[model samples]
Target: MADSQRTSEPTNFVHQDEIWKAHVKVEKDLAKVWPNKWGFLTETYKEYERESLKLKEEARMKLPHHLAARPPTPPEKNIHVSRSPSVPQTTQAFIGWRSAHSHLQLEKYGTVHHGRRSFLKELGWPLDACS
Candidate 1:
């Protein structure tokens, strides 16, 4: 039966030489359809790069001389102070001294800052506690 013949087909029928010849044939067919494919792509990319460079040069030339020469100024720093009716000055000064580690008391706080970690645990570095 045809079903029996299909079931008994040899598994090792494919040869490396036949596969290589088929590959060569496919490449030849592609070459006939599109000759110098890689060369055409390279030329198109080069043309695009050339046009981009030309446009950049033209844009640079159009900018005003003073705008191009001078650098932008940095933003001004503003300090804010708040006055409260009930809170004593000494209490606020003590809190500032504790946070800054400085002897002089600060009236207006700029930013609450943290010091660098002295131990591995503070910096989140892993340590073997069992050993």
Candidate 2:
């Protein structure tokens, strides 16, 4: 079944983090919209609160001892994102840090592939791979 297949997919850690971050965002939005005729608490908000707490508890237990001892910190701001000035401002395209790093690798290594061995092999500039 489609449902079963969807559930079988492994949950990504980043996706989980995003879900937790969304819960906090929802709470903030609720607070800001409270007491306004147009802004009312919805059933979705209640569901988010319940789910977030359950996920948090599970995560805490799974955390390493040192991390568990310290209070959890808020999600980090996305500072690693790179902006491409060559593209037109009106167009929407996000060039991440990985893309920029890949560009640097290409320039330095000349068509070097990704991975540990390939990276180090490229560093042997004057000598080619022997045997």
Candidate 3:
């Protein structure tokens, strides 16, 4: 009977109301323990941010007059221009290349033998009776 029960498919032992009651109880317990748990963490983060901003302001004030007066220059944008004209330019050709790449990747890595059963089989465990 114990072995049969172990092998059988699991059934819903707890009803909807029971699950709801349990959830509500857990929430109530959490509220009792620490109602402002998330609020405390947020307040701590805000304090840290305030300190960081204050430090940044102090650093800016300490900078040399010439460096502080000068306007910040925009970063240069890196534009990539493909030199090869024979490379796939059309959408269809690009898609075909992508598909081929994916197929090659699958061929290199994909395998059928996997999961817990496979692992057990590799370790010389007889899983035929269990299944």
Candidate 4:
């Protein structure tokens, strides 16, 4: 896909602009790693990717157009997630724009009820649904 076209496309409805934003975030994060061997997000990052793929799959099958603009279909309740080294899982934490629940873990301490929201807000997630 052309760079411009790719930028214009939505990964899905619920997550439209993140694919590119994440790349930029990583590039900036990597610059701070200072020659570290494991600079990239490892298990959590991989899990994020896998989860993103799953969402994409579901979108293609259940809601293609919705995927392009699908708001989170939360399970009618707030959920708290614990972090894991394995595949990333999602949390119902609605912190802010910096968060991507598609495949992320909870805070290490789990102190915050909505870690995703805080993390995302720090990352610049919009304040809209992030209460």
Minimal lDDT window, size 10, model 2: 89-98
**How many collisions between residues are there in candidate 2?**
0
Q: Tens digit of lDDT per residue, candidate 1, span 31-58?
A: 8867455568878899999999999999
Task: Report residue 33 deviation for candidate 1 (angstroms).
Answer: 5.1
lDDT of 1 at 123: 69
Q: Which stretches of candidate 4 lie over 4 Å from their true place?
A: 1-40, 64-131
Between candidates 1 and 4, the TM-score winner: 1
CA lDDT of every candidate: 0.68, 0.67, 0.70, 0.66
Model 3, range 1-131, lDDT digits (tens) per residue?
Answer: 88898768665667767998999999999988784666688778999999999999999989988776765555544533333334587877876564455433435466566563576677887777466
Assess every candidate by TM-score. Answer: 0.34, 0.23, 0.34, 0.19
Tens digits of per-residue lDDT for model 4 on 47-94?
A: 999999999897677855644666777974676655644343455343
Ranking of predictions according to lDDT: 3, 1, 2, 4
Model 2 segments more than 4 A misplaced: 36-131
Give residue 123's error in model 4 in angstroms.
Answer: 47
Stretches off by above 4 angstroms in model 3 are: 1-10, 13-20, 31-33, 36-41, 65-131
Scored by lDDT, model 1 comes in at 0.68
What CA RMSD would you report for each candidate?
19.3, 23.6, 17.4, 31.0
Which candidate number would show the highest lDDT if scored against the true structure?
3
